[model samples]
Target: MGWPPASAAAAAAILCLGLLASAWAASAAAAAHGPRALAAVQPQPTTHGGLGPRSRHHRHAYAAMMYMGTPRDYEFYVAVRVMMRSLAKLGADADRVLIASADVPSDWVRAMREEDGMRVVIVENLRNPYEGNLGGMNRRFKLTLNKLYAWSLVDYERVVMIDSDNIFLHNTDELFQCGQFCAVFINPCYFHTGLFVLQPSMEVFKSMLHDLEIGRDNSDGADQGFLVGCFPDLLDKPLFHPPENGTKLNGTYRLPLGYQMDASYYYLKLHWHVPCGPNSVITFPSAPWFKPWYWWSWPILPLGLSWHKQRWDDLGYAAEIPVVLIELLMYIAIIAITRLARPQMTKLCYNRRPEKQGALVQGLIKLAAILAMVAAYTIPFFIIPCTVHPIIGWSLYLFGVLAFSSAVINAFLLPPLAVLTAWLGMVGMLFVMAYPWYHDGIARILVVVAYAFCSAPFLWASLVRVIDSLQTMLERDPYFPRLSEPAQETEFSKLF
Candidate 1:
């Protein structure tokens, strides 16, 4: 038997609440351990002793750092996991270490150590001396000063500090054989800090801290700038050539560009033609918004697929799938309930409006409605988990945008097509940018610009239509009769 309207709505509402509760429960469970307590947890030492006698005497580690300051911390966590797992899969004879801030969830720490085979060193977030001086892009690097903690990892003789936005094309074990301080000069003068090798020494770490205290000449107020300030002579250092006899070198050395291949280079030639050293790692040092882990970055940054492939192979997205599924179900429930109850909802919403409201009041109401529509599109874009596969990510986004937009359309009594023009335009722009046949990045950017130019007129027309519809709604008689008059079923109610 078909269910009654009220009963179906009650059931859907209950389902929505239950899904929300589940999501909250999952988050609460992950954060069960208090941050202060988690911060006090000691660094776990590596005890996995399967890497032959070299593991006994010569300790080496591949280390990365994580701190929570931005909205995208979880995405970086996933990226770190995938990179560390890829390193493990390459059968590197070195330990994988994560220098994470104490505030990072204990669950994330546990997963990294127990599942990804990483040694966890929980440390306090390092204070950025250049914090007040930072502006624009430099502000995001405030907590990046924590990367200096790599030098405090005294347990390992040699540590390769890497950023999370790197994909391992091959094992970089040979990097451990380099000197006390080594880095690749992706630029002509300054070395890229995305990946660097350093020998652990408390003295060096202390000296770096002192430099920060003295307000050293840091160009960007980030670790990259501070390190560049500290090691100003690295660019002139002799290029590192790993000895066949396995003798470790001392002093600073410049690494070959292949050790840290910029992902942008591939777009130029569409191939890995790096001639120096080994083409071992690909780093995304481009726009922060277009990081490899973000789903929308794939077709635009084709190497992003390689990152996802490593993730699929080593660290599966199983941990992220449940939340995504729950959100999807909630969105579907919302869309269904709104569709089923639209007529009654519209009548109830319209009945309460005063017949003689002022023009200022009406204008404010119209402005609010417009703002609601704008939020419907944008707020969903930020809420979706960032690292899901492109297909799943885009699907969830479309569903979310539709679900939110539907409510706005029903509430405002506007034409659906006009309301959806922005969403359609966004999809069109994405298609323009994602076309795979572009000869280079320049061609792709040009095509996207052309598409935007062509679509702007239609988008402006749609906006005008939406505003006109709002004005018509304000001017026309109310859909429902006032409380003084006897209620009568209108044609809209009859159709429902």
Candidate 2:
């Protein structure tokens, strides 16, 4: 049966309300230790008189900028743009929104410029830094570093540099109150940069630029790596709180993952006891909140709202309107696909195409199986880490990804290959954990390999879904089978 609109609408409302309520209960329970006045998007404790009522009447919002430079489509960019626009509405100066890309469609550029006052910056001369290099993002990372240096001149104080996948839930003026030379947020668990709040000084920002230039060739291509290594001095701020558990404050050891910013949420929100007044301005990364987005992680909605909850509350029905629109668009897409495919289905019926019937059934079965797998995957995702020790759970998680991938390549069937891979990874992890901190021999390399195994699944699965989906689609389509390169035949896709 087709999903009913009213039902979908009700479900969305219930889901939203449940999530918000659950998150709020979680926050309120945590906050019971101490009460906090709702604050803007700054790094201050709420008990410190968040945003002075007087400042609300007189405060000027700082100009913040972010970009989407990835090869992925513009959905993440659009989400970030929406977030930036939300920032503008929060009783502050909403000027200078910039979206950068290498080859943005003119239509999109025109829409953003004419509508949102966003300038599109494009970098076309980008190339890999090493022609003979294998598995190195050094050149591109270096070029991006150079570009950040160029962006420093934009002259915005307390720049809240966020990923293009982030959303803003409040007035960002609170970030500027930070008088620090610079502010760097390490997810309570790992010192990494999915997001950062930078106090812009020609001196500080320029020094960071220099660091990026120097570390451009380092094996680690993270901008965070350059900042951590060169600056030596960093304003590590506590950007989140996980009050649900006794992890009073998460501490930063080395980044558990590579430059990648994913971390155990409960671990990431523990307080670092960094010295700062309750109302200090700061930055939060795109992880921790674990926004239920399909592409990159979503902004920490609670953090985003905690900082801008009032502005968001003020948004009223307006916020609901966009969500409703998105849902309606999805509904429209569903209807369109169903109607168009019906005609094709009718033709197949008249021709009595047995192969066509099998393909259609196979595609539907594959889709059903994929949905089931995704549901199963969600169980481990929510239950793990918070329940299991992060290091141990993360190891299991690393194992899970490879198992899932094997299933994908083998047409969604549960593969024996996955169980073997998991056992192998678990054994490898035990050996590595046994090593001394400064192991001498393959033992050290084994530790690194084990760590890599722990992170490999999510990293691999995120990147390979589209490729895997295309492979499945090609296999199911008789027309695609006749093509020379089955993977390249998505252009003939009749199934949306």
Among these predicted structures, which one has the highest lDDT? 1
CA displacement after TM-score superposition, residue 45 of candidate 1 (Å): 16
Residue 344, candidate 1: how far off, in angstroms?
3.1
What TM-score does prediction 1 earn?
Answer: 0.81
Q: What lDDT would each prediction earn against the true structure?
A: 0.77, 0.38
lDDT of residue 406 for candidate 1: 84
Model 1 residue runs over 4 Å out of place are: 1-58, 68-70, 101-104, 122-130, 135-143, 152-157, 209-217, 244-246, 269-271, 275-277, 348-357, 478-480, 487-496
- Model 2: lDDT equals 0.38
Pairs of colliding residues, candidate 2: 40-307, 43-281, 43-282, 45-278, 249-270, 249-271, 250-270, 250-271
RMSD of 1: 6.0
Q: How would you encode candidate 1's per-residue C-alpha lDDT over 1-496 as one tens digit per residue?
A: 1223544454456446534644563454243321323445443333211122232343899999998767567788888999888888888898888887767878888989889878877776767878876786554788998888888888788999999989888878888999999999998878999999999988898888788788888888889889998899998899999999998999999999998999888877656878877888889887888998888786777777777887888777775676676667767776776677676555533554444556886798689779968867875565566777776777778878888788678767888999899889888876776677777777777787888899899889988999898887666555555435677778775543
